[model samples]
Target chain A: MRHLLTTQGLPRDEAIAILDVAEDMAAVGEREVKKLPTLRGKTVINLFFEDSTRTRISFEAAAKRLSADVINFAAKGSSVSKGENLKDTAQTLAAMGADAVVVRHWASGAPKTLADSGWIDAGIVNAGDGTHEHPTQALLDAFTIRRRLHGSASRGRDLDGVSVTIVGDIVHSRVARSNVWLLTTLGAKVTLVAPATLLPVNLSGWPVDVSFDLDHAIAQGPDVIMMLRVQGERMAAAFFPNAREYSKQWGLNDERMRALPASSMVMHPGPMNRGLEISAAAADSPQSTVLDQVRNGVSVRMSVLYHLLSGAVER
Target chain B: MSVRTVLQHADITRALTRISHEILESNRGSDDLVILGIPTRGVTLANRISAIIESVDSAVIPAGALDVTMYRDDLAQNPTRPTRPTDIPHGGIDGKTVVLVDDVLYSGRTIRAALDALGDLGRPRAVRLAVLVDRGHREFPIRADFVGKNLPSSMEERINVRLEEIDGVDEVTIG
Candidate 1:
């Protein structure tokens, strides 16, 4: 409850509790007022060291919906961009009385450092950090999955006996890393599908079934298929052969999309490369929960904030 | 699960009569009273409480059901059938003493969420919580102002209250 750095270390019951609470928070979003006075006088700060539209906005919205006063600090125009250290920024936010800080940083363990450094007393949440973890995003994805598969039945169930295939850009995707650990922890069998070069070295210790062939992984019939975005920015240094070739071999096109099981759900942590990692049709399909992931992000984040602030722990 | 019936139909009816008299005596009159149920079972409890008050006093107490499900903190953990419509009475909650009625009190989370939910309707002069069973395991620091029965039980044991309006039987059991 102190900090939500990663879903890797969380107990299954605790993680499910957060997801369950998010279901309630999602209800508040569908209301006429679209807000609650739970954190009436509390202050939440969105500290972004990296440029992000969805996560920053989602955290801001979640805080506002809970009636907490929000302050957005982006490194682009702020003092942090001008070479101010994280220590100074943490100290400053602390001085301003931030009850909770939702941080998205380029460095892998920035949130952990902030939470453990004692530079601030605020509850620190990792919005995202490098290729390390995006716990909240993974949580929302799991929330979406539990809703799609179980509905209210999520109370007693884990992702047990479910198979999840994560496709593309494993090397640079925090989503993939987060899901691999989280889904595995919840008892779902995870399979990684990507080109050998894009796959991380020494993933043998990670609890997942690895595959270099997308067709083979598809044939395995996973319960959920999470397609990761090919980071073109990271690929400018020739990480892959070419866009056309990558799309041909690893991309999710009509054939691969059609090959998926009827009950299987398709997911993507956006902003997507329309014709690169996944086609336009797959992104907009009925099986797609990309949009629902965005909507559920608010609720999932609200659940995180509520637990961190309200101190609601599952017994 | 072994369930022991704690309250019979007559016991419930007698408690309703006593609660109505107590509410009327404390508030001086039923003029500014508004009974609001906390959805599902609370609506029935609020109705019965309102009916009992009406019989004891000359004037009628306005009653309605408010759905606080949408304002809960954990909406996505379980599958929700989508948000249900709330039926608020004519004049709204402004300048009125809104008494929130519920069947059981566990962690006080429901009531805490209900307070936030009520603020959106309009500002109430005062808001009070009343529960049939105060089972005394509070995660949040919340308490019911009025109680029908204070049943002490472990967190593992649940108090199942079945009203005639919904369950076709009026009884309180511990399972």
Candidate 2:
């Protein structure tokens, strides 16, 4: 619970505890004054080595809502792009008296390296590190699903017997990897559907049922269908034949959206490529929790920051 | 080393009835009064008091929960406290006389947190405090306006208020 580097081995109890705390944060958001005095003298540093406007701003909003001072340090204009190592950059941030650091790097496992190096004596939160994991994204996804399913009675409840079908580029998605592990840990049955070329070869540790046909997964009436964004920039070679074929095969278009059950939820960890991964009809549908996921991301990150940096860190 | 029951079931019932009548008399018939309880056991007491007021004054008074976990001053030092439901009743607390209720009054810090929490929701016309047991040794300059019983005890001793809704008993105990 000290540093949320990965969701691969996160315990069910800790995950549920964070979700329950996120419920409190969501309530605080609805108040007349959307602020809390919880993390009052703490300083949070958003150290982004990668460019993620959505995630960096979400963490910043979460910290500011808790009355914490936030300092955003992007590597684009900083000394990090000038050949300085992570250890040196971390030491500089440590000297600035950062209580927590939300790190987003293009290299996989960079957040883990920052946490384990002891260069910065602060709680490390992995905003996103390549394709390794995005823990808070998964946590917010889980929070949104729990809210949709249980409404006001979501406290202390896990996703037992819930079926979550995640569809998209599994190989290049840290969001898919994080959600597969976390949703299953919360007692959900996860099924991953993607094109064979876009799916990862080494699925030894992923606890999910993989399928090449997206229609089969959608026809089964899952409780939740999450479409991950197809990272076109990550593909060096041609993974799929074409965008039209990919959308026709795996996209959550209007036809695929109609195949879902009435109570089913559609989700996307977005900056969505509409008409490519998910259609405009599906993304703007009433069942789509994409907007709610963005709204709940702040609450989930606030709960994560509160758990990691409230006082003495717990390893 | 031993436990003593200061207020039993009948004693609690009688005390809550008296507190209810006193609330009605002071608020002049519960017209613009909102009864909000600090969570856990105070919610039960607030509901009981609201019911009693309804029976006596024949007016429906809204009762809800006000959680002070976020407004706590000790959050940075202690472990994370799980928050309960902070359900503000339908008509809201703006310009209404809010009666804040709790099970015990000690250290005066929780009430302080509650006051800060109430400030964020909306400004009330007037705010009043009520508690079942007022154990002395307040840290802040806070005093409950209504008290069921004043049991001045030491720091080492614990004041346990068990309600039938949660603990299967209605009694105030000192150990």
- Give fnat of each prediction, in order: 0.05, 0.68
Q: Name the candidate that leads on TM-score.
A: 2
lDDT of 1 by residue, A115-145 (tens): 9999999999999998899999899988888
How does each model score on lDDT? 0.85, 0.92
What are the TM values for chain B, all candidates?
A: 0.94, 0.98
DockQ of 2: 0.66
TM-scores for every candidate against the unseen true structure:
0.76, 0.98
For model 2, the superposed segments whose C-alpha errors exceed 4 Å read A311-315
> DockQ of every model listed?
0.12, 0.66
Q: Name the regions of candidate 1 deviating beyond 4 angstroms.
A: A312-315, B1-10, B13-99, B103-116, B121-175
Q: Model 2, range B65-136, lDDT digits (tens) per residue?
A: 999987888876677677787989998999999999999999999999999999999999999998999999
Interface RMSD of structure candidate 1 (Å)? 8.2
Task: Give candidate 1's error at residue A207 in angstroms.
Answer: 0.7
Worst 10 residues of 2 chain A by lDDT: A306-315
For model 2, residues A238-308, the per-residue Cα lDDT tens digits are 99899998999999999988989989999999999999999999999999999999999999999999888
